[model samples]
Target: MEVGFLGLGIMGKAMSMNLLKNGFKVTVWNRTLSKCNELVAHGASIGKTPAEVINKCKVTIAMLSDPAAALSVVLDKDGVLEQICGGKGYIDMSTVDPETSCKINEAITSKGGQFLEAPVSGSKQPAETGQLVILAAGDKALYEAAIPAFDILGKKSFFLGQVGNGAKMKLVVNMIMGSMMNAFSEGLTLADRSGLNPRDLLDVLDLGAIANPMFKGKGPAMLQNNYSPAFPLKHQQKDMRLALALGDENSVPMPVAAASNEAFKKARSMGLGDMDFSAVFETLKVLKHSS
Candidate 1:
């Protein structure tokens, strides 16, 4: 099946490369034309716009940054809306609010287009390695049709059954992820301040039931102050903010998520916004010295 990919930022680039490597015909479009260079060189077709991508493929997946960008690519001139119609499938893998997903779903289905909100649960490595966990919802038929593509892109894919479910599921998962990162940051800094090697602490965590790939993977680099943008800190803050809004809308108490959101905001204020989300560890170091 011909696949169209919109957006070529960190996640999008990694993902489209995986699809191309797997022998899929992929047509890609990015806001910045230069961002498509690597993929274009790797035997992927280059699309001038979202509409062009949709026109060239039966299934088009977009990994946009946030709600506004998500909305823009679909609603703007030369957008997905222009080409979406019967027999076409649109999958959005962006982490956004449930309401936003619903809005997109409505727009696509109104024109007889199949829509699926398929947000992911992993960062750069997982995306590149095709190990992401996909939370998909919307049309079941579309989900079934996209399974071949999803299998190549993610380690697991869950069909959550409805337009908003996938979006809600993604937020809940990311909320916990953000909260855990905050706890991890605190533990790392506390260990350092107490004259214990944080690396040793990482070993201890790894030996316990709390062991997770995130800590094991991000730990060493974080200790070396390598805050590369696998997943930008600003985007993490955006997810935290959206997750908190989801909590408020549902009357669910989310104190931990709220606190984590503030920590992310503080990290952004420290000019770590463009760095990896792990840069929140930097914010922890700043707080340690400030106090």
Candidate 2:
């Protein structure tokens, strides 16, 4: 099937590259046209707008920054819904709340287009390597129909029932991730203040049951004070807040997630939003020194 990809940010570019590398016919569009240049050279077609993409492809995938951007592209004046028709498929890989996903699904289904939420679990490197885990939700037939494309973009894909479940799953996963990162930041700061080497602390953690791929992956970067944006702090904060909101709506108290949200809020308040989430370490460091 011909696929159109929208949004060419860090993860989006990597995912689009994977699709191209796997020999899928992909047409791409980005708000910043320059972001599509490299993909264009790699034999991916570039489109000027979402309408043009939907016009040319059977499946259109979006990996935008947030719900607002996703809504803008899918519901805008010349957006996807404007051009989508029966037999066309729209899969959103952006991390958004379930409510937003449901709204988008409604718009697409009303227009006779199939909709799926297939938010991913992984960062840029995983996306580039096709190691992303896709959490998909939509009509069963539609999920099956998109498997070929999903296989090219990810290592594994799960069909989790109807639209919105994928987004809900993403929020839950990110809530734990946000909390873990904050806890690790505090631990690292405590170790350093006790005159214990950060590297040694990382090594110890790696050997313990508390160790996870997140710490193993981010620990070195944190130790070296490299805050490059594998996942931006602001986005992580957004996900945590969304997760907290979900908890509130369901009447399920997520005290740890709530606390993590506050940490990310503080991090953003300190102008660390654009940095890698591991920059939460810097927040902990500042607090430690002040104390």
Candidate 3:
């Protein structure tokens, strides 16, 4: 299969690389052209603009960082809208709000292009290993058409109903994830301050009903103060903020998510935004010691 991939950030790079490794011919684009070099070295072609990529491939997938970048690449000069036409499918797997996803969908469909919002759930390792879960919606035909590629990018893909469903599902998932991470950080910090080994806490948690891959994967790393950007703190905070807005739109209260957002904000204020979301551990640790 031949396809176009946009945005060569951490997630996008791994996803596009997987496509190449799986024997799909891939064309890539990034605002910073140099980011394309590594993928190019691995036999992927480059498109200087979003239009060029869309022009050359029947299916184009975008894994941009946020809503603004997502909009710019599709609405700006030489953007996707410039070349999108009937039978051309665009799958946006960026983690933006439902409204943003709908906006992109409307624009694409108006231009006779098929659109799908396909935000993903999973971090760097899952993305690298194609173990990510994909939440997809809009244009069921496009979802079915892109399955071959989605099969390569995600371990599971859910076809939600419409344009905004995928985005909402992604936000809800990330909100819960952020809340859990905050709770985990607090538990670890409390354990350490009480003269208990945080590692033991992790071990106990692992053997319990609440055990999850995230805790198992990130627990030891958090205890070691390893905050390398698997899923950056800033992005987590962004998802929290978006999810809170979603709650407001639905008249649902999300106090825990709100509290988690505050912790993420504090972490970002402490210059840990670029680190792993688990770096919230540092923020909690500091407050405990200061008290």
Candidate 4:
């Protein structure tokens, strides 16, 4: 299958390369043309603009940073709308709010293009290994048409039945993830402040009922203060903000997610925005000293 891939950020780059490696003919584009070079060397074609990619492929998948970027790439000049016509499919795998997903859906379907919102779970390692879980919704036909590519990109894929459901699922998942990271940060800081061995704390957590891949994978490096950018802190904060907005619209109180969002905001303010979302641990550690 020939595929159009827009965005070449951490996730997009990994995903497109996986497609190319798996024998799919892929065309890629990025706002920064230089970012596409690595993929070009891997036997992928390059598109000069979003429209060009859309016009050239049966299915175009986008994994952008946020809702703004998602919308801009579609509605902006020389964007997807310019070339999305009947028989074309556009899948936005970016984490965004339901509203944004619906807007994109309406715009695309109105132009006779098929639209699907498919936001994924898992970060760098999962993306690279094709172990991410896909939460997809919108045109069922498009979802079916995309199965081959989705199978290559994710370990499992869910068809959630509507354009916005994928976005909602992704936000809820991210909200829980962000809040758990906050609580984990608090626990680590508390363990250290009380003269407990943080490594021992990780061991106990691993042995306990709450054992998870996230804690297991991120704990050791986090204790050593390795705040590398697998999933950047600022993007986590943005997801938190969007999740909170979803809560507000539904009259639901998300106090814990709100608190986690604040910690992320503080982390961003402290210049840790470009680091991994776990970098919020640094913020909690700083808060202890400030208090």
| Residue 119 lDDT in candidate 2 | 97
Candidate 2 local lDDT, 170-193, one digit each (tens): 999999999999889888877888
Question: Model 4: which ten-residue window has the lowest total lDDT?
Answer: 282-291
CA-lDDT, candidates in order: 0.93, 0.91, 0.95, 0.95
lDDT tens digits by residue: candidate 3, 1-291: 899999988899999999999999999999999999999999999999999999999999999989999999999999999999998999999999998999999999999999999999998988999999999999999999999988998999999998899999999999999999999999998898899999999999999999999999999988788988999999999999999999999999999999999999999999998999999888887887788
lDDT of 4: 0.95
Q: What CA RMSD would you report for each candidate?
A: 0.9, 1.0, 0.7, 0.8
Of the pair 1 and 3, which is ahead by lDDT? 3
What is candidate 1's lDDT per residue for 74-140, written digit by digit as tens? 9999999999999999999999999999999999999899999999999998999999999999999
Give the CA lDDT, 0 to 100, for residue 80 in model 3: 99
Best by lDDT: 4
User: On TM-score, who's better, 1 or 4?
Assistant: 4
Clashing pairs in 2: none
- Runs of candidate 3 exceeding 4 Å displacement: none
Per-residue lDDT of 98-198 in model 4, one digit per residue for the tens? 99999999999999999999999999888999999999999999999999999999999999997899999999999999999999999999999999998
Which residue pairs collide in model 3, if any?
none
**What TM-score does candidate 1 reach?**
0.98
